[model samples]
Target: MPASRTERLLNLLIALLNTKYGLRRSELRETVYRDVSGNDSSFGRMFERDKADLRHFGFDVETVTDLGWSEDDPATTRYRIGKESNRLPEVELSPGEWTVILLASQLWERAALGTAAANALRKLQASSRLTDVELPVGVQPRIKPAGRAFDDLVAAMHAQHPVSFSYLAGSTGKDEQRTVEPWGLGSRFGQWYLAGYDRIRQAPRYFRLSRLTSAVTVLAKENYAPPKHFNIRAELDRLPELPLLTAHVDVRAGRLLGLRQRALAGTEGHTHTPDAGYDRLDVQYRDVEVLAEELASYGPDAMAVAPGELIAAVTRRLRAAADFCAAPVPAIAFHDQPRAGNVRKRTSEDQLKRMLQLVPFLVHNQGLHIQDVAERFGVSREELEEDLQILICSGLPEGYPDDLLDIQWEDDHVYITQDLDLKRPVRFTVEEACALLTGLETLNGLPELAEGGALESVTLKLMAAAGEEGLRAGSLAGPAVGPADRATLDLVRQAVSSRSQLHLVYLSPQGDRVSERDVDPLRLYSLDNTWYFEAYCHSAQGLRNFRLDRVQELQPNGNPATAALEPNEGFPAKLFTPNDDDTIVTVQLTRQGTGLADDYYAERTSELPDGGLLAEIRFGNTAWLPMFVAQHGGSVRILEPRELADQSRAWIEASLASYGG
Candidate 1:
């Protein structure tokens, strides 16, 4: 018996799978788990845990009890992994289905779901052949299920359990603890939402991920199953739209560039101040609280001059920020959560998973070079050798040479002499099915990619293969970021396909400046709900990214692109590209605003005594510092760069003074 837990699990799995009649507990303890030096009770607990672990890896461990005329017989129970129930059935995917699968797998970048999608793809790849499908370049569409809430919510949904979390009610502007049975998670209007039954309110409610004010607590004791045939898209679509209201805001001159872009033309009223000048504009808003949050984030630079509700809301938040900043530091700092599990334990789990796929892959592609095999699995040659050694030692308990899996890699080429019975990859679990299928569903909205209804066809086929459990995919969804302007998207795609330059009249968000430029199209991609394309601007003579919606005019220049195309292979995960000369500003984040640390790519962070986080983040310039502070309300406070901090404080104070604060 091996000392390694991973090896023991592997041997146990082989023995269970190969057994004709299931192996009894006593038989398993004697042959497969001979290393168990503890008492009978300890062995029973360990066996139970191992069985649960195997189930976690998507393998069904079937239990058969020898009943004497239907009477109970726990002592005669046996365990085995039934081949028919465990192995993945033959899956035949069309060329189009394969293409969408490839695209869907690439959609999740660095998010937790990315791993599940990748594993699902690998199993499908191992089971079926792939057709050559060229994915769109520069058009990298990605979905980031951000925050710990998303991770916890997904787990809860998978477990069919209720969850309790602190959520800020938008209408009342207060945090409330709500117990909810999460039914579905999806994106609508550029934000992630959890659709669930609120137990406290006794009604179905939709929760925006951002408004969650605390960590989600999964109520495992209270389990639930979503209503049959509940469609998340339809539910989200049924949400009512808020009435739009016009806000009269006064912004300091040459500031609040983002707000300025949304301002109505010819409505700018000018006012002079001792320190600066102000321009008043009419801005359309759907929610007072949402608008107030934005205005308050701008600190003293922008003021909600009209609409009593907006003004009151903004003032209250500013006062809160003031009070929060002046509060005493906490006496103790929070301990950090472990970033990962034990190194050896994780490595063993990874190896076990990789070996499960390796057996089937090697069976299909025999006598491949050892190095090639290692490269295919993204492992070093030495690591591959270690895995191969483990495989040769794994098999039945008969102790015959034929009982063990036979392999040879001495000649730099590898071959499986006798694969006991791991010829097919395991079936997809509910989580894996959800990750891939939900991603494909999001792509269905894009008519261009759904050519000939390939996306739909593929989805149906994969769902059928995954069985009834796969339908639970409707519980999770991505934001539907379809082409806002098909005409514009079509032209951009054509220009890139033809390798031609495009002349465009574009709006620059920096200072509300409109300009004409010729650009060589590089890639077209999307973040959340907006589409953007990266290109080489002939006018700027450098690389730039342009939002599709901001293009007022676009036409091909009818000339070949002079600049070589260097399409970025991966999505630009960062919104603000840092440079060597970027300014490093330090700030303190209240518990609610700690998420900003990841959002802004904080270079360094430390726990503050007051249950807050101190983060050092880089900015290209300090022009937006005041706006940043105001945007987060009182949740973030600038700590360093005394000059900037003073300016932000003065800005807030000035705005508060206008409301007689």
Candidate 2:
């Protein structure tokens, strides 16, 4: 492996950051470059390259001449990061804006967090408020998430390198080796896809990360230029939504009824046979294979009446499943489990991004307390110091010290003197923009916003700030919260802010029950594009979250005087707090289930040699464990937490029994 020039420069930077009087060249060689010190000429060349590197990274390194130190010795020179040019000015951010920024950071799961998202968050948090902010709940907007090979792909793109990987072709369902020059990444329907020039196919193609069957390996150092007009968003939209095919089935009131209700309003018809009891069922599907599996679970109760292929597909699947169940299989011991593995390693992208943001902040806002800065970034004071040390050599080219970034500090207070390229602030990535725009839309639909106010202007300005690309984010299609939901949101916001009570009818998530109750509204928020009304429920006498969509009716009533609890003082914080106690579960996945590993198991998953996934997941609670495992079917096996296996198995049995399969 080659020497880490990034590390060598970082060492030199730390030495410079730690002292008022910068160290001499002789001192740097003895300390930072000690292992491989060269003669004077070679060392000089190395120092020049290091300076140029720093300058290229936007550091402003300045050298001061020591003209008359002593008559007996030749005058020497010293270097230091100046305090004025390098620090960012104090940034202005609203509490609402800060919370939205925080939410935007959640667009990706674990593996994706370390890239651009992490960096932007570090910068936003450095100067933004940490608390006393009202957060809009559950409004997660994901765009081009960095899934499994996200980091590697980004590195290859940045370094201008080609990458090779095993891809499972969507049409063929076969793994094929591919070499591609990645152009850009995009997202549609909440899944990530990579657009690249496929060398093997000799065409530009988009690959879904979920379908990738192997680790991405960067090929030898050869760069390919992207087409001048290449645009990820445009190409992503060009993927075209396939037309939904209409399928006629025979079924009556049951799970099929629920599916019918979810379909487009006009696409329903029935045979209306009283004696047979099976109604002629009609449903539309974009993917016949997936739809067929779902229909097969309904057994003889549901049958595809027309579209011979659809009937054949469903029959084929049902027969295959029956054959599997009929065959005998050996049972394994209950305790058979793989040994625990190390936690997933976080990518270095986050650290690099933080430094970029930190530089502008230090330049603009000088003399900030180190501890305070650390708290803003959710990092320890020691970690902050270490980051600063690494930033010392973060400038232009190594030998080109003319534009070096100058970092300065006096004990607890930090100062930036000269920052060449670090002064300009970082821009929001496309994903961040999508999330922020979606959050703004939620706020835009409020009744207060409809009446023409500050929010209206904010909506227009924010969307405008997003540019064309923001408007083009396909996953953000259609209004997330329509006028009806917004109207409810407005009333709920009023109740929360005014400390009033609300009388409303709410349907349970299972849709089996509905009841009217009085609630003291606490917060009106959205989660994952779904609006939720959280409040102190008088009926339950505790804090509860109600999905706004399930809320059938709402009427505001009572005043602050009628409130059961005082504002900010007696508010039950625990009522809405999520549990932190964890239960660890180990699971082994077949090749088919490996794709979801990057999504749900990014922090705890390890890749198996057979392109499967070895995941040890930690659940905050096991309430959803059974259902979650059941969703993936037999391809995913729960290996640990013996109780989980039993529960999941029981749930699967019950589900099958309910379907009469």
Candidate 3:
């Protein structure tokens, strides 16, 4: 139902407070309730009712005392919402800002704020008189939350309480307990993180809420204080200042490592010892684990220089990963394995038939280089080149003669000539269909997959192919799992694909509400069984992550990318190379953190002094890693990069507020 006049008046009052700092009696009489009603005689009674309503709604409104011009001047008075209100300013948002808000709202819904944020957005739109604005064509906005657990975490945050949840450390099949005082919710690079005090290790931790299994608010409202001297912004700036770990390896034997370093160099930091050997060169990185992983492809030729702990950690993690790769799978007879006879093959021609299917992937990746195409199909350069040639030759019934299939090659680069019709019929073999179904099943479990109907439609197609006869023959005819809420998922997917911004009516962890944000969509990933969207947030003007389920309504608007993509002029080239000392660090991990060690180090392993693993890692930004370790409850520790260790300690201490202790 639409709000009553009184409710509208209340909203107007709040808006007035946000805009003018405070409202005077005369101003209130002249403009406050103009949109709702013009009854001046009842203004006094309305004011009393408004104050009562605001207080009832838990708003801390205050009246300041005028010291000098009092009794003689008819007692001038002004009213304003208190500091606790944390109300944002009231201003006209550009179309770009609206796009950001819409995107944020969609992500917020996935974090479990769908209903609340949606209602709030409606209210905001109504109040802003923006209900009739039409979005530009080709603009779509969508946001899908990570999951129910993430929602619970957001709720707990707003309640200002501790929360307990389970998280998978790495690819390992182990789960651990984590308790934290919710600090703030943020999105980075399309992933959402809950920054707070990790109670287990007594440090400030950033937990990827999407990775959490289950979350619930603790009854305790502990008074957790942030560090007096700690500043997140400062910490972010100093991230690239950490020292690098150096190593030497044979270039031929370590060709992969050399290539990775070459790619990473100039972006991070690296220096090559050219005379070390024809195929051997010395390399440096900020983190040993990262270096170990890069060099793992070279086998024994990659040797660590110092930081004995990193050497041990890299070795252990690589061995474990190798073991996983070598682990035997249960051997089943050909007859025992699921099968179908005389099925068709999934040719590239078949893929061209589904125009919608191709459009999303194509648009998602604006340009496709030869290397990118090769990686996507796991094919050789020659094979990808041939495919591109074939694509250039293929097309639909004419619209523009050059519309469907056109390619331009320049200096070894490839560009698409035109749009795809996406209406082609792609045939798949029975076995191929089954394999596709299985893949879809796995993707269904991901949080982001929920937003794109492509997955759902694929599943339905798989079911149809399975057929009633196949069902009678004991073949599964439906998806193993049910579909998620479609409307919500569709909203988020559209927003992301269309690059439209959003307005988020988000419910903070402290139960307070906010309804403004401008977010740039980057990538959507699944971690710990949930979905998260990492993006550049215009509100914070830095990279942030968002939980999709918390998002609400996703409106569309025209806006260019919030931040411009500049050439690598001032880009941290040193950070990308092994030469920069800031890129290397040693991390100590217990046996339990071996999975984390392996993931970062990929193929490197090292033994630690304390019978643990000291994994070396090379990283550009320390922002995400600290939060990752904190979520592990001290299982992983920053052995080197002293600044990071100190920051972690300060964060924990601040979260463990001395509640009269």
Candidate 4:
């Protein structure tokens, strides 16, 4: 009826002839035009029309004699299309090419694709007739840029024009107005960076597009010339390596030593000779403060050996940290404090009541297990189970078969075998939204998170959930917390979750101190108006704790997770005890000495029952014990351990005799 339809029919006939070799007129009528009104046309007219269409369109349709039919019985005429009809070539693609095609199809969003590129891909896929294989769940490509900044930059590059933007240097907290000659945009390590010459620095610099606050096209035109000496791969090779700083100092030989060797290999130019019994290693970095902070994490084992300048820099930082620790603690504020009128409105009885309201939907809709759901929602498995039991009793229609509830449990696993008419999808409450927004906003301020848009998306979602009016009202309500504390909290949370040891410079009553420790992070909780990490220390090889407010710097230790502990093990709950027949060390103290001992041993000291000061202490190694005891002077005396007593008395006598006391 229409030119397009006639053309399609002719193509279909040609395809059939090529595939089936030949088709009888009766068979063609049944298969091709079975439900069409024109199929009843006289055989002679249909044959004439077919012949006219084929000849007009340059198709070679021909008649072939039926060998089994006699001349008198002319009922078996057969038609065929030319061999040229089947001449389409087979399409072949290499693995790499196929990979590129698939990547282009999946990762590059519609806005990023050119019309030609998109059309070509679709045509190629149709012609090839490739099998559609399903990608595994959560196998999404990491190609979404922060927003449209990257896409716009790419468009500018294609148009061969310069671009202007305000950029922030992460290394130095400096904002510079910059204009760059367009070169090219490329992706490296899951980040999109634009490589071009900086108009201000007069050198080649790369700007991560995601970090660009504002960017626009510039009218300036410049010849495109890549620097002869520029080699992106070579420059990337010299970028600073992530420093490995840990608190647990172990000198055992084997893979641990190998790891230390690898960490210090190229940086040996900065090390000095070992200080007597102690081995010394120095690492030079562009950021000495960062390196010093890393070294201080090693505590007693790794000291910042030299380059007085770096040590001074670290010392300056430690001073600032001490100031923070000395500052008065802030008051804890709670949201939605119970009002006088609302006391009788009734609230959830306990954490169990909250869990009961939250668990069933998470199990059935989110497909989460009891343990995972517990960790994510910050609850326990027992609490989750209690909620599930309550949920099992909640259903419509009141009884047995008519009830809208069904659950199946097998091998310690649970499944919601039937649907329940739940009205709402899981969501965060207003207070939860506020907390999440504040946390994400804090994370977004960190240097490490600046390159990833994940935090930005989270912030937007939080704001949307708060509603426009509520968000505006909250913003006007003034600041609830500062960014520095938030950053510290985020870093500690990451370290704990990752199970990586940390290097921190801790400010104690005794000047600035640095320590590296292998910590079995048990919990992070606030105590006595300060934040503290309760952990099992590998260096001390005992249960130890540290004040977060005193922590100045934090760094990751790049050792295997298993190397730090036995698999799936938790921190010991009790205080450490010395072995039997081990030297029992006792110390006696005078009035002034009592205060010092009490301050140091406040948590572990016993009253002695007889109203005497006989404080007991244990040491894994006694090399430095004498020096520590001698520091207390005349007010201190050893009460037990004959050898240690004699050693300490001799050291004290020697010091006093030198002073002519």
For every model in order, what is the number of clashing pairs?
Answer: 7, 55, 116, 11
Top candidate by lDDT? 1
Cα-based lDDT for every prediction: 0.77, 0.57, 0.43, 0.43
lDDT computed for candidate 2? 0.57
| Angstrom error at residue 454, model 1 | 2.0
Candidate ranking (lDDT, best to worst):
1, 2, 3, 4
Measured over all alpha carbons after superposition, the RMSD of each candidate to the real structure, in angstroms, is 5.0, 9.4, 27.7, 27.0
- For 1-661, candidate 4 gives per-residue lDDT tens digits of 3433343343334334443356556656654444445534565466567666544333456666578675333357666665543222223444433433443333332223222223233323323433454332111121233234544554555444667887756566445778886554543433445777777788877776534544354544654454443433345335454344422122222212322542443334433444454444333355444454444322233434355544444343333233322333232222332221101112223332243224334433344455764553434677566556655554432235535345544454556754342212222322233233333432332343445554455345335534521242121011111233656656666766677666565544232235666565544533112346655577777556566766667665664233344312222111223444445466654322343333333223333322223455555445545545543333345555667766655544443332233
- Give stretches of model 1 more than 4 Å off: 1-3, 69-74, 137-139, 265-276, 287-297, 306-351, 365-393, 405-418, 510-516, 539-541, 570-661
Candidate 2 lDDT score at position 605: 63
lDDT of 1 by residue, 266-329 (tens): 6644353323488787899876767887888766667787787788778778887777656664
Candidate scoring better on lDDT of 1 and 3: 1
The model with the greater lDDT, 1 or 4, is 1
Which residue ranges in model 4 land beyond 4 Å of their true spot? 1-360, 363-382, 397-400, 423-427, 468-507, 510-563, 566-661
Error of 1 at 487 (Å): 2.5
Clash pairs (backbone) in predicted model 1 = 138-523, 138-524, 139-524, 296-630, 297-630, 297-631, 300-651
